[model samples]
Every structure is written in structure tokens, then in C-alpha cells.
Target: MVRTAVVNRVQDLWVSLAGVGTGFPTGGVRVVVAPESRLCPPCWAGIVVLGDSGIATAPDAATAGFLRESLTGRPLRSAVEAERWSGERGVVDVLGPASLAYLDESEFRPATSDAGIARLPTGHPALARLVADVSEDDVGESGIDEITSAVFVVRDGAGVAAAAGYRRWPRSVAHLCVLTSARLRGRGLARAVASAAVADALRSQLLPQWRARPEPSRRLARQLGFRELGDQVSIRIAAHQVDSNGDRGQPGGRRP
Candidate 1:
């Protein structure tokens, strides 16, 4: 279980992202017009339900009003739910509904030995080769290329069998990411490299965050002693449904 302090730290991070300092009501949702909010993805809007406190962002006050109207009664499970009540302006290109988790050092189950794990600089040639070895979808899911921290890896004769690292997000969050070769997955390469990465993040005094949509990834995070905190989803809403050129309009294709 995550400690109370650790829990609050995560809460504070979301609150900051939402740009709601003291206005975030207790046990209630705060709908704000913050197009520039770090919380807002490239989509029209996004909402994060963190325990009793929740925040929703919109591009303008009118849009904020719509979000407030739908999100008034209680916290939503995800932005997908927001689509149901959006009327004609339906959501498109929904990003997540992913699980957000955090780690506490006291409960961290670091690997017993780091014998095979090696530390490498960001954007190393071996890392590039490993990225090339994996499927495009796998690389996108892992977000391995965005890593700004030291990468931990387990190597095989071909190249890096598995690699793990973190992207430094806002509020000192070390967003953990792990990727493994399809052929070498059955081995414990992911666990070993990820453990090394998590250890490094904790040592740097950054909060380790794990966001996963896949059960296996969630299981790996749980195995490493990360606590499931909340769910986050981003939805792009349709603006006018079509453009002046009489062309089809995708909701998430262009910012509404």
C-alpha cells in the first residue's frame, strides 16, 4: 500500500497539472478553462479523477460549461464516459482510460541482483537497434524514444534484449517505460532492467509513475510494488464536423 504522504504527492501533481491551486474543491470536481494546461493533451479536453478530487479542462469558458454540465454530479471513470453525454459533439481519437500508478520506496521490490543489467546513455546505438527490432506499435506503446534519463538494459548477442527508462514529466515525475524484444519476452529481462530503472529514479528523488493500458504491464508494475492510483483519459471533441473545403473532418484530427 502507498503511504499517505506518497498519495498526497501524487494528488498534488495532478492538481498542479490542472492549474487549480486552491480552487480545487474538496471531494468535488473543478472544471476550469485552461487550454494551456499541462493536463490537456492535444485533444479538446481531458479529465483526471484522483481520489475525491477531480479536475476537467476545456479550451474556453463555453466548452468548460459543457464539461461542467456533464461532470457535475460525480467523478467519471474516464473520458470515454464523457463521450456518452456529449450530444452532437462526440469524441474522436480517444487516447486512454489507462491506469495511473505510483511507487513508494519502502515497498519497492527491486531486483535481487543487477548482474546482467547495464546502464547506457540516452539514444545509444544499441537502443536504436533494439527499437528497430520491435514492432512499430510496440515502440509507440513503450514511448522508449522519448526517454530522457539513463536507460537500463539487458543485452543479447543481437542487441539489447530489453530496456527500461523514464521520461521526466512535469512535477518531478519519472514516467517509467519498459520494452522487450518479442522473442526474448519469456525471460526476466524486462523485470531486471525495469528494476534498475526504478531504483535509479528513486535514488534521484523523483516520484516514479507507471501508466499502463495492458494487463501485463500493470502486472509488471504491481510486481515492482507500484500502487494503482487512478484513471486518466483524453478525448478530442468535434468542433464544426467539417471544414470550408467540404472535406471530412475528424474530431481529433484538428484541434476544435
Candidate 2:
């Protein structure tokens, strides 16, 4: 009994450390507090952040309802979440299975960049179309523009099937996102686009951050020289109780 209670306490502490709350949808896409939107983190699967908080599964109606009730009017002051790494604070060395293994310059090879650049055209319809087809939880028009350094529409001389983009961040951090059409299933377009984006980020001195979905995708990332940063975990709770500094305990808690 004592061990169980202790374990629960520890788990609760972990939850508190990760600044978690519900994401509310606004303007089509669910708008949760994402610190790295500028970097255009992947929006297809779980949402990721560069700061203390990690990636979170976007809240749906059921999830949102739970958050609204739990947090109420309280404010979440901290940014915390489960980190995939076990370190005090450091760069994520994602160079193993489940990541792109190519060196920085290797990413910029002609073959990779070629497809990524072509997919996203000027004022192309791919953006809106992708959002419409993918999920009702799109970030809307702004999301279309926000997710790309430049958009490319991938085609095989027929019609547009997939769209790709590159996003960058300070301190050598970068990422890629590809929106594929429903008709084109089991195609390798996403991987090609990802390679291009990684190449671009490497050329510009931005470290690549890859967020792959499902086991196969994760395996691809690993093969491509990108390692999983770690599983970003989140939980909902009363916002007022969250701590900003990595410190948690009773209010007016003594300084360590």
C-alpha cells in the first residue's frame, strides 16, 4: 500500500512538472499553447514544443471537455512535459534508428530538394485542400502559411498529390511537414519531401527535428539519421497549480 501511494505521488509530480492543459480549437485548428509554432512543428500527429513542455495529443471534443472542467479559470504558468531524453538540459542527439542518418550536407542532395521545392506553388490550392481533407482540426488559412518556409506541390506530371514545407528555429533546430492527398495512399511522397526539408535545414545550419507517425514512419526517421527526441507526455489539471520553474510542491514551498 505504501509503495502504491508513493508511486501515485511520483506520477502526480511528473504530471505537475509537465505544464499540461486542454487545447481549444479556434478557426478550424485546435489552438493549444505551442512554443515552437515559429518552427512549424508537425501538426499531423501529436503536437510538439521546444520548451519545457513536450508534444501533446491534440485535444478532441471529449478531451477538450475534460480540460475545460479540470482547469476552469486557472492559468497555467509553467511549460512542462515528459521529455524523451534523460538529461538535465541539453541538445537532443537524434542520430540513430528512427531518424535521418544523413549528415547535414547530405540532406541537401539534389534529389531530395527537387521534389520539396516543386510541390508548394505560389498561392497554391494544396494548403486549403490538405486541411479540408486531412482533419477538421486544421489551423485554417494562417496555418497554411504558418507551416512553411516555402511550400512545394509534389506531382508526377499528372495532378498535385502531396505538399511539403520546411520550418526552422534558432540554435540549429528545424523540421518538415508534408500534407498528402487522400487518393495517393502507400506512396513514398512524404519520405521524399521529408528528405528535402531535412536537406534544406542542414544547408541553413538548422538541426532537423523529425516527427514521424506510426511504427513505420518512426523507423524511417531512424534510418534517415534522426533519433526520437523522446516521447513528450502531457496531462490536464488545474492551471493555477502549475509551476513555471521546474519546481513543484506546496504553495510558498521552501526553496531547494
Candidate 3:
């Protein structure tokens, strides 16, 4: 369970991400709040409130209804349990059940000198080349452009050995992402670059947010002084559109 203060901060962050004047629904499920025409991710709409209580919101009333029906009666003790319940329903795709970690300035520790490391501009050609060399699809061109902070890269004769950076989320949160070349899998380059990025974020007074799915990523977060804030689960409904009458308008399909 997350602390009440952290939960409040998370809610504020969500509201900020959703844009000005957007607020959490009073109770039950309501339409998902997003910035302008941008669609919020399905999991982003479902939040774990007050510990075990899971609230699912959507952009439309129909989707809200679907989410409400899916999560209303369940006791979700953790993000993993929420994911399992969402999976069995067969109408949504579950992501996470992963750790939501963060680091404060006092806890951050920068890596020691490493000659192979360098700070790269967001969307730098070398960074792109590195990502390509590593065959990483998680962070794309758009993702690089979205990052409002520094990008750190480590290179070897082969190419980019590792890369790390953070994208600006609402409420001064820096969402960290890291990737390492397959050839350098066991090396400490990932940790080195990630530490550089974290140090930079702390200098800017931005709380570094690490949502780690992979075990290595989680370990790295802890190594960099990020504490486990909580767990999160996100669900994506199969139906692309909802009708005006709060209905899915078609037989729903399921995704894993």
C-alpha cells in the first residue's frame, strides 16, 4: 500500500497531467480525463485509491461503465492482483503489477567517473543509432522528442553500450527510461548512465520517477536510491470506440 501523502501527490500529478481544471471523479467511475484531444492510456485511467480500492476512469461513459463493471467488486490488494482480475475478464490488456519507485535529492548518488559516458541531447543521432544498434523498440523517436531533460549515453567500439534519460511528466516528475545493448548486458554501463540521468534530474529539483517492469530495472532503481513508492496496474480495453449510450457497441474482445 502507498502512503496517503504519496497517493495525494499521485492524484495531483494525474490531474496536472490531465490539464488545468481536470479533477478526480467524486465516486464510482467517470469519463477519463485527458489533455485536449490526447487520449490517456487505459491503465492511466485506472488508479489504486486508498490502498485496496481500485477506481477505473475512462474518456467516455461507456468505457467507464465497462471498467466499473470489471473492477467494482474486487479486492485488489496489489497491482498484480488487479492485473490478474483484469486479465480474467478478457476485455482489457494488463500492464504493470510493477513497482513505482522514486528518488529524492537527499537519497541520490551519482556514479563515479566513467570515460565511456557522455551527455547527449534529446533525439541526438548517436542516441538514435545506439537505440537502433540495441534493437530497442520501447523508446522511439517520439519518445526521445518527448524527453525534456538530459540524455546520458555510454559507448564502446561496437556502438552505444547503454543509454538513459527521463521524460517530463506533470508536477515536476521526471519519468526515467533506460536501455542497454545486448552485447553489454552484464556490464554496469546501464547503471552508470542511469545514475548520470538521475543526478541530472535531482540537480534540476525534479523527483525522478522509476516505473520498473524488468527485474534488472527495478534493482537498478534501488541501487540509485529510489524507494518503492507503490505498485501500479494499467488496463487497456479492446474496443476502440464507445457509443453515446454508454455501451461498447460491439462484442468486446480480450488481450493479454
Candidate 4:
């Protein structure tokens, strides 16, 4: 089980992302309009379910009212059950049921570094080659290019075999992003690089969060001493629903 402190910190992060300025719920789900919310795309509605505490958000008043009226008082899981609640054009795409885990400094188990593993800039040539080596879909899933922190990588020949980093998100959330080339799968490189990145985040006093949709990625996070506290899901409002209002991957990962 995760510590109470861990869950509270994660819940607090989502509360900030929800942009509602309301206290985290004690039970059931709460809905609010947070057009400025970063939990999901600018215009799209989203949800973050933490145990029994759930927060759902929409970009504007009308859609927000629809969701607030339809979803509040429902089970916390309803936050992710867009098909049942979003009646307009229905759900567009659901991001998860992704594992949301966080690292505690005391529990962190750093991976052993290899001679070839080193820190790299996000724009390094090896990273570019690694991106080209992987499928476009996988590249997008990994979010390799979007990280705001220094990248850790293991090299194969001259190109990267695996890489890891995190986005410095709001509330000091270090949202981890990791990728391992298919050819280098099962080589422990993902763990090596992810370990370095997580350690760096910890040294900076950032809360390192690993959100993984893929079981392999989830396992890697667990191996690194990140306790699974809850789960995450982001929802997209359908077109017709958006007409009334205005608004806004599993990246390839190897087993730890």
C-alpha cells in the first residue's frame, strides 16, 4: 500500500491541475469548469481519479454544467466512464486507466549505470536518430521530444537505444517520459536511464510521477521504487458538444 503522504501529494497535484481551487473531494466525483486547466488539452474536458477522490473538468460553463450535473455524486470511476456520461457526440478518445505512481526519496532504488549510459540534451543527434528508428506512433507515445528536463540515455553504436526524462509540470510535478528502441528491448536500458532521471528529479526536490498505460512501463516504474498511488484518465469531448462551447501513447518501454 502507498503511504498516506504519497497519496495526498498526488491528490494535491491533480487539484492544482483541475484549476478549481476546491478542496479534494472526500468521496464520489466532483466536476468543475476549468478552461485554464492543464489536466487535459486546452478545449477538451478531462478527469483525474485518485482512489475515491475524482475531479472532472470542462473548458467552459455550458459543457462544465452538463458534466457537473450529470456526473457529480456518481461513483469516482464515473470520471473515466465517458461513454455513459458524455451523451452529446459521445467520447472521442480515452487516454487511460494508466497507472499513476510516485517516488519517495527513501524508497527509491536506483538502477546500476553502465559505461555507455550518459546524460544527453533533449535535442541530441542520438535522440533524433532514436526517434527516426522508432515508429511515429511510438515516438509520439513516448513524448520524448516534449520533456523539459535533461535526458538520460544508453547508446548502441552511435544512436540511442533507450532514453528517459521528465516534464517539469505544474506544482513541481516531474512527469516522467521514457522510451526504449525495439531492437534493444529487454536490455535493462530503460531502467538505467529512467533511474538517472528520477534521481535527478529527486535531488531537485521535485515530485517524480510516472504515468504508464503499458504494463511494461508500469513495471519499470515499480522497480524504481515508485509506489502506485492511483490511476489517471483524460477525456476528449465530442465535436457537437464542442460546437456549443469553445476549447482545446503507450511509448515503447522495456521491462525493468
- Every candidate's lDDT: 0.76, 0.40, 0.61, 0.75
Q: Rank the candidates by lDDT, best first.
A: 1, 4, 3, 2
Encode model 4's per-residue lDDT on 1-256: one tens digit a residue.
3337767778878888777686567776677777777677656676777776777777766666656655755666766654554443446666666677899899999986556778888788878778888898788777889998999998878888899999998778899999989888897888999998999999999999998777898899999999877766666655444333443211111111
Error at 2, model 3, angstroms: 7.0
lDDT of 1 by residue, 15-128 (tens): 777654534456566777765666656546777766655677766655565566556664355333535534434445566667889998999998778998888899888887
TM-score per prediction, in order, is 0.85, 0.46, 0.74, 0.84
User: Candidate 3's residue-wise lDDT over 208-246, tens digit each?
Assistant: 888766787788889888877556555565555354455
Better of 1 and 2 by TM-score: 1
Stretches of model 3 off by over 4 angstroms after superposition: 1-8, 18-39, 42-45, 48-55, 78-86, 90-92, 114-116, 138-146, 238-256
Write down the lDDT that model 2 would get: 0.40
Name the 10 consecutive residues with the lowest summed lDDT in model 4.
247-256
Best by TM-score: 1
Alpha-carbon runs more than 4 Å astray in model 1: 1-3, 20-24, 78-89, 241-256
Candidate 3 clashes between residue pairs 3 or more apart in a chain or in different chains: 32-58, 32-59, 43-234
The 10-residue segment with the lowest total lDDT in model 3: 34-43
Reference-based lDDT, residue 2, model 2:
25
Residue range 161-185, candidate 2, lDDT tens digits: 5666655533345555555666674
Number of the candidate with higher TM-score, 1 or 4: 1
Q: What residue pairs clash in candidate 4, if any at all?
A: 43-247, 43-248
Off by over 4 Å in 4: 1-3, 72-74, 81-89, 241-256
